[model samples]
Target: MRAILVLLIIVVLVAIAAIALGFVNVSQTRTASLPTISVKGGSAPAFNVQTANVSVGVENHVVQTPTVDVKKP
Candidate 1:
C-alpha cells in the first residue's frame, strides 16, 4: 500500500511538472516574419492583327486478356 501511494505521488508530481512546463512554453512569445506581396495593374499593351493554321491527330489502343485461374484448399 505504501509503495502504491508513493508511486501515485510520483506520478502526480510528474504530471504537475509536465503541466507547468507546458504552461511556460505556451506563455513564451514567438518571433517570426512572414512574406507579403502587392500587385497593381498598369496600362495595357496595344493589340496587333495575327493569323495562324494548326492541325492535330490522336490515336488510342486497347489490350485483351485470355485466361485467369485461381485455386484454394
Candidate 2:
C-alpha cells in the first residue's frame, strides 16, 4: 500500500510538471521572418472570362422529439 501511494504521488507530480511546462510553452512569444517574391514585366496575352450566378438553398427538419431522463436513488 505504501509503495502504491508513493507511485501515485510520483505520477501526479509528473502530470503537474508536464502541465506547468505546457503552460510555459504556450505563454512564450516567438518571432519569425518570411521571404517575399516579386514578378518582373513579361509579354503576356490578355484574356476575358465570364462567370454565371449560382443559387443555393438549405433546409432542415426535425423528425422526432429529443429528451433526456435522469434518475436518482
lDDT of 2 by residue, 1-73 (tens): 9999999999999888988888534455788779898989999899999999899999999799889999998
- The TM-score of predicted model 1 comes to 0.31
lDDT of 1 by residue, 5-53 (tens): 9999999998889888885344558888888988798887999988797
Worst 10 residues of 2 by lDDT: 23-32
lDDT of each: 0.84, 0.87
CA lDDT for candidate 1: 0.84
